[model samples]
Target: MMADHENAGYRRLFDGDGLTFGTGFPLTDNRTSRPPVERELELAAHAESVGFDALWARDVPLYWPRFGDAGQTFDTWPWLSQVAARTDEVALGTASVVLPLRHPLHVAKSAATVDRLSDGRLVLGIATGDRDPEFDAFGVDREERGARFRESVDLLRTVWREDFPQVEGRWGDLDGELDLVPEPTTESLPLLPTGHARQELEWIAEHGDGWLFYHLPESTLESYLDDWREAAGEKPYAMAVRSDLADDPEAGPEHVHQGFRAGTAWFREYFRRLEELGVDHVLVSPAGESPEADLQRFAADVIDRL
Candidate 1:
C-alpha cells in the first residue's frame, strides 16, 4: 500500500518502499499525428483497474510539425481534470510542462485547480522546454528559458503557499493586492524538475520535491543515482521509458529509443534491477499494435512481480 503525503499524487508515487510504474498519454499509438483521444479515458480507467500507479500527459503547446511529436493533443489541465474524474486511484500528472512557454500565474492556478479536482492527486513535472521553432512562435526568448524556469518554480511555490503576497519576477509583479484562488489541496504542489531544466543537479535536488528524467542505460543511471544519493539523499527519482514487448516471453533485450524492446521475463528483471538501483518510479510508453493488452500484460508481468 501507498504511504501518506500531503499530496495524494506524491504519496502514491514516492511514499513507498520499492519502484513503482506509471504510463504516459497517447497510450494507444506511437505516432507524431493526432492520437485516439476518444479511447484514452477508457484505456486510462482500464489501466487503473489493472493496477497502474499513475497516468501522465505531455504539455506540447503547439504541434510543431518540424518536430515529430504532437504530444497528447489536448491541454494538460482539462485533459488531466477529466482523467482525474475518470480514475480515482491513479495519480495524474504532466510528463513535464514547459515552464518557460507558460506564465507562472496561469500554470499555478491550473495546477492547483487540478489538484483540488483530483483530490490532491497532481504531481507536476516541469521543464525549460526544447524546440526553437516553438519558442519563436510563442515570442519567448529561447535563451532565457532556463532563467524563466527558475522564476516560474519559485513563483508557483510562493503563490500556492501564500495568500495575496508580494512577489516579483521577469514574468511580472504580484503586489499584495489580489490572490490566486482555489489554492492546492496541499500547501504546495509536488514539483519534479524534468531533464535538468538547465539548472545544476544540486539546485534541482535542493528545490524540487523529486526529479523526472529520460531513460538512461543502467551503467549511466547507476552513476547518476550515486551522485543523486550524495547530493539529495533519498529524494525520489523518476524516468520515462519507451518500450515494446515481444510475443515470446523468453526473448532477450534489444535497444530502442528511450528504453528497450524485450520479452516480459527479461523486462521484469530489468525493472527489478532499476528498483535495486533505487529508482522510485518509471513512466512507460507502450509501443505495440495492442497497447491496452500490453498495459495489462506489463502490469501482470512486471508491476505485480515488483
Candidate 2:
C-alpha cells in the first residue's frame, strides 16, 4: 500500500524492508517556549546529511501553560516549509495536526501549498486532539470531537481529490461551486491517523492511509500489530519513543516516560526487537541537555550501524 504513494517521503521512509529512523523536531529536551530557530535548521541539515529518513514537527496551537512542552514552538506549515527549504531530500512530517481544532479547508490549503512547495515530501499525521482546556478555548465540544474528526478527514480527502466537491456535514457544507486550488503532488496526500482519535481500530484501518501509534511495550506492540495486520493488511504502522541515549555504549536501559534511557548498544538491540515486532518506522525523540550533540551521536553510533 505504501507503493501507492507517489511522494518521495513515503517511498523512502515506509516502502522499505527494515525500519528507518526519523528525529522529532525541537530536537531538544528544552520544554520551554521557542527553541532556537537557527540551531534547529542547522541540526536538521545535519540530520539529512547523515542519512536520516525524515524530520517530524508537532502541531500545538494554543500552548496550554499547564501542559508545558510547546512542540517546536513554531506553527506546522511555516516550520515545515522552512525545514523543506533547508533540507533537499529528507522527508517532512507533522507528528500530527489536531484536525478537530482547525477547519479542514484551511488544513487542505496549507497542506497542498506545502506539498507542492516541498516537491511531494509531506506526510500528514492527523489527530482528534488531546488537551481538554484547549478544546474549551477553541469553543469545540470535546464530546463531539470524534464525529468532527471523521467529518474533517472526509472533507480533507474530498477537497484534495475532487474539483468543486460537494460535501455536507455537521462542520459545514460545500455545494461544488468553487474548487480548491493546488492539488497535492500525488492524487492524495498521504495521511496517518494518530492514536485512536476516538474511532474504532477497524474504522481507522479502513479509513486511514496508515496508522500512527504511540509507544508500547514490546509484547503489547507485537500483539497489537498482529491485530492491526488483520484489519489494515500492508498499510504501514509508525510509533514514537521519548529516549535519552546514554554516553556509555554498554549502559543498560532505564525506563522513562513512553521510552527509555539507554546506551547506543542497548538501543540497537531494542530497535531490532521493534523491527521484529512489525514496526514499519520509528520517530525517535533524542532527549538530552545538548540535543545537537545527542543527535549526532545517535546518527553515528546507532543509526549508521542499523
Candidate 3:
C-alpha cells in the first residue's frame, strides 16, 4: 500500500493500528462567509490535549459569496505554522491544497518550510482546483487543471528529493545548477490526493503517498477501499465526515452534508464501523454554535468512546 514515508504527520496517522480522528478548522459551522477564529488556536491546542491526532486546515483560495463559506480564512501557510507553534505533536494537514493554481516550486518551499517548522508534522492533501471562478481568477483554464495537477505533483516530489535536480515541465525547467533548499526533514512529504483530483484512482494509488477521499456510503466506501487495496496495497485511506453531533447520545442517524446528524452513541458506532472498513484516519468538520465546547464534547463523548 504505502512506502515507509517518514513524515511525522503521516506516521502518527497511518502508522497506528486503528482509526484515528482529526478535526478541521472553522472548527464549527461551515455556513459562514467569515468564521470567528478567535478561539481557533485555543481549540486547536485543546483538541491536541484531548487525544485528537491531527489538526486540518483548509485551502479555500477565494470566498465565493454564493457558497458563503470561506474555508479557514487565513492563508494555510501562516495559519498552519501558527497551529504548529501552538500544538506540540498533532499532525497538521491541509484538507486539500489547490495545486493547479499555484506553482510547484512555491509549494515545495512552503510545504517544506512548514514541515521543518513543525518538525515534519505535515501531510499535504492536494487536488486540482475545482471552482471555475478560481480558475478564471488564477487565469488557469479549468480543463487544464488535470494536466497541471499532475505536473505540479510530479515536480514537487522531484524538487524536494533531488538537489538541483534536472527537470522540466509545463511549469518550467530546473537545470542541475539550482537547488530547492530546506528539503523536508523526512525522506519526502506525504501526498494524499483528495477526491479524484481529475486523475484516475490507479494514478493516485501509484503516485500519491495516500488517498483523501470524500465521505461516501459504507457499502460504497467498502467497495472503494477494496479497489484501493487491490491497486495500492496497504497505503492508508482517509476521508472526511461532516458531523452534526446531536446532544442526545441515542439520537438516530439523519443524513446531512455528506455525513450525518446523530447522537454521540450513533456517531461512536459509526466511527467504529469505518475503522472496521479499513479506514486509517478521518477528518471531522464539526457543526455547532460553540466550537470549543462542541469539539471537546465530540472528543469526550464520541471519539473517546470509539
Whole-model lDDT values for every prediction? 0.88, 0.87, 0.87
- What value does the lDDT take at residue 196 in candidate 2? 88
Native RMSD of candidate 1 (Å): 1.9
Estimate the overall C-alpha local distance difference test score of candidate 2. Answer: 0.87
Q: List runs of model 1 lying over 4 Å from the truth.
A: 1-5
Q: Write the per-residue lDDT of candidate 1 for residues 186-263, one digit (tens) a residue.
A: 888999999888999999998888889999999999999899888888789999987789888889989989988889
For model 2, residues 1-306, the per-residue Cα lDDT tens digits are 434445878877887898988988887555568888888898899888876899999999988888877788899999999999999988898989999999889999999999989999999899998889889988999999899989988888889888898878877788989888898888788889999889999999988888999999888998889999999998899999877888788999999989999999999989988988888889998747876678888888888887
Q: In model 2, where is the ten-residue run with the lowest total lDDT?
A: 1-10
Task: List TM-score per model, in order.
Answer: 0.96, 0.97, 0.96
The Cα error of candidate 3 at residue 219, in Å, is 1.2
